[model samples]
Target: MRFYLQACLLTTLLGLYLCISEDSTNQDEKLPTIGVSVLIRNKAHSLPYFFTYLVNLSYPKDRMYIWIHSDFNEDNSIEIIEAWAEEYKSQYNGMYITTNNSSGPLHSGEQHYVKWIPEHFNHVIKLRQQALDFARKQWADYLFMVDADVFLTNPDTLELLLGKKLTVVAPMLLSDGLYSNFWCGMTENYYYLRTDEYKPIREREKTGCFAVPMVHTAVLINLKRTVTDKLTYTHTNLQSYDGPVDDIIIFALSAKWNGVELYVCNDYVYGYVQVPMEENDGIQSDVEQLVNVKLEAISKGTPLFWDPFFSKFVDYPPPSKYGLDEIYMINLARRTTRRELMEQSFKELAMDVKLVEGVDGRTLDFTNLGALGVTLMPNYEDPYHKRPMKTGEIGCFLSHYYIWQEVVEKGYQRVLVLEDDIHFTPYFRIKILLLLSELEDLDWELVYIGRKIMTDDEEMVSRYTSRPGYTYWTLGYILNQSGAQKLINAKPLEKMLPVDEFLPIMFNEHPNDTWKSYFPNRDLKALSAAPLLVHPTHYTGQEGYVSDTEDSIVLDGSAFVDGRIVIDHATSRIIGRINSEL
Candidate 1:
């Protein structure tokens, strides 16, 4: 009986130990290895932004194996890639670089970077095959192929693709127009056919993982769901090769033949693909001119989107280097949090600031315009918004008005006006310095450091800046003495309007034909920095962000449709999405 009891006790102990061991194994499991393959041809202009996003991917750097091929080069694109690879070479598990493409290199300026030549196309396919084979040999669990022009804002792009568990997938990339990375249907001629679902999915009106005919630019191939050996990007796997000689199309055909499903996920805004522009400067505008990475999360105004999550505000010198008289931030008394955030940002950057106390419209008596030297049309509704201005809007306008009044009263040469919720770009100080240098000789009253491009006519004034045609957002700007005097002389206090809308009217750029008649002497020479130096700290749906004029709702970002601009509601993109995933 004693021996039997001992045996039973030992068995129970052994069972508990096994359970604990299994739990430990599960907890310490290694993440899957990812193989990143890239094909570049004279896209060095966009490399800096691409590298910025690539280095910060959420996945472990050691877990990612990189293979870069610049088959046909014309400029220093190969050199740029080599430079980045040299810096980050050790961080990755493995690195492969090849500039040998039998297709031959193009001269300084030959075919457009995006060419359809058979030889070039064939070489692309061959290189893709080589990359895939290389990934397979490395025992990679997944393969990521990103073109040089693709900019991934979301660091978890790889993880997100993996979660879908699809054979092949890509995050839909947006452009200035309706261009994206996926095609809904392929025609008989094997060209892209726009279907009804294409626009809706691309616009995120219908958000989900959608099965599509083609996916490229930035796509992930899940080896777990696919047969590694059966895949080919060339015509070998295709039943018929009547399609265009483009490698992406051929790969799509091969994918279809190999029983692989291609999908594009639009559930979230990941990043964007740089569409081919008419002028081929062979350098990325963002790198050459400090252009903002064009995106579409907050407003549907311009391709240039504000990415505060990765904005990575660096502790650089202040705009004082840009020759501004004084830096002032307008903050509402109730918004202590915004003030704190802005204060911290400025403090970290080590900049002096003068806080402009915001006036509460709720307490103001607009009954007498003479006393305030401001005229507000009685019961005046916004012409475009088609609604009476909110009390908050009144407060916002007055806050800005009081600042301009200060600018004129003090006779400041150049004063930077910033809203309390302003978010700085990573290279704000340097970019501003570079931009102001270009504008020093130009004639201008108001120089906008940041704004929303409401129209398409953003004509380039200098290499680094543009003439903003009907822009919005008074979030950041440098008001000169002339600008301040013009605002006061325009009798803006008599006809009250949102500061943003009023600025456009004052600049003679408002698209609305009706508002021009209301304010006739409207020609305040204004210019905007191309990439925009600042944006709101919180995007439309972000938790702490508040817009008095645009959106009064404290939550639900989708409701923030500023003048028919439809956009997705972001729930703190990185953290919120991860929580939901968990």
Candidate 2:
């Protein structure tokens, strides 16, 4: 049984010792146990995403205990924790939930004794101390400090951490980007605090922590004798603050103080959400075929970097003009064309209910100038071939770019870009209208017009952009004017990833932009709140995919087109090539 542990080269001495000790241990002894502590507030917003982790944890349920520490007495936070505890207990019988009242935002490190509304810095430090105390009292071997918003993309995250010597803060990598706040949540103070004479690191790629950049919700810490002895926690550098007191800085300072080797887990498994990946295959369409191809390639040790841009949801080089959203849509179309199955899939996607123009053939019910914005499905020259060219999705990009240039000329600040084949929850439109109304005051840049698996309650921050939790699916997001400007003024479409994944990546990746998630793109909200979008599952009584074919389609002698069409009952396409034979 080979297990991989993550660490920086600074711990070479300790690493050798640990290896020798592990080798000497008898196989009869039970494997070291890893305990996880999660601190959550405002359960309504963050719990759903937490639940996804609870149900999908990668380690053995019996070997792990999840301690939920929250400040929820006055507000409904405790009740939400209690409810989730019951569910977790029902599933993972060994899991436990604990509640504590926080002194509300600790403003400074002083005032250690608990008081209601303690300084934000004090509150977090105290909470961490409390969690550590609980773990010590319980006699757990290792403690995993996690946040409610953090989830494991790879279910075997624990397996990866087992037997590791104090795995410092690490972030998970996804097709979208790194899955940790360490990258995206950095403020001016954050960089300054991390370094001695802090000079703002402007590089977008220098996201992951230098010497464990972040102690985000998901960190594996060891309760080893070496660590337990030298650790004397203090709060002197951080002054009056209202929010998270840069725990990563504290960890770094402590590591410097003690001889403890601060291992920076640089693996993708321990990365934060902001550090963008080359591309993610998980969120791509034709998943089965894609997965099979990747798996086969991996088995054969192939580089599997062919058409690297296609794997990205956003093109690498963003469009360099105003209102180039159309080019992005076309880029997505070209990528989807790679999979032969996407052609009919999108046509099937069109069967969902749409607000059609009655007789004018021009306007629809979606035109709400007051509270909500509306998207008018423009008819392209060839319609199906919304673009003009074919092989490898060339003209589609130009066609969409032209469309965006026209729309921008019409004075639309922010518009929803939906790739006609996108499926939605039944109430997607209604909910979007309400979201639009709510976001009238918000400074957002984009609004997704699709369906996705949403997690978390309401108050979610730390999005890849200043906006968090709105990653992966681009089905529905609301962009404000500034964000709109950013998109329209971006670089070439080829410079970035796909649009759905690109906006959040750019927002978070940008050295200056401050974006956060106002709302998560989960299904419950999309359906219950009358969002007004539906998939074939709601209309044609079919799931999203039905066929297992490997061919494209041709419509009216053209291959590239916009608007959804179904090949069978389940699959659909956004913009794809036509099968010459069909």
Candidate with the greatest lDDT versus the true structure: 1
Candidate 1 Cα errors over 4 Å, as ranges: 1-30, 71-75, 100-116, 224-228, 236-239, 278-391, 399-545, 549-582
Please give, for residues 1-582, the per-residue lDDT of candidate 2 as tens digits: 123233444378688888888888845766567677877654333344345555566666666777776663334556666765775675552576666656452234533222323355455677777777777777777777776544354566666655344535444332221123433233545453343311222222333334533444456667756555334233453344333344555654465456555433434333212121122322122222223322222222221232222232211222121222221232232333322232222222221221211111011111221122211112223222343222112222233334445455665555554443333432222344455565545544554444342434324321212234444434334333455445555532422122333444444421212111211221111111123242222222333332111012222223332222223324332232224443
Please identify model 2 stretches exceeding 4 Å from their true place: 1-28, 72-75, 90-96, 100-118, 163-169, 172-179, 183-210, 236-248, 269-417, 420-582
lDDT of each: 0.71, 0.40
Q: Against the true structure, candidate 2 has what lDDT?
A: 0.40
TM per candidate comes to 0.60, 0.43
Model 1, residue 243: what's the lDDT? Answer: 71
lDDT of 1 by residue, 509-566 (tens): 8877676667788989998888888876567786665675565321112222221111
User: Mind sharing the TM-score for model 1?
Assistant: 0.60
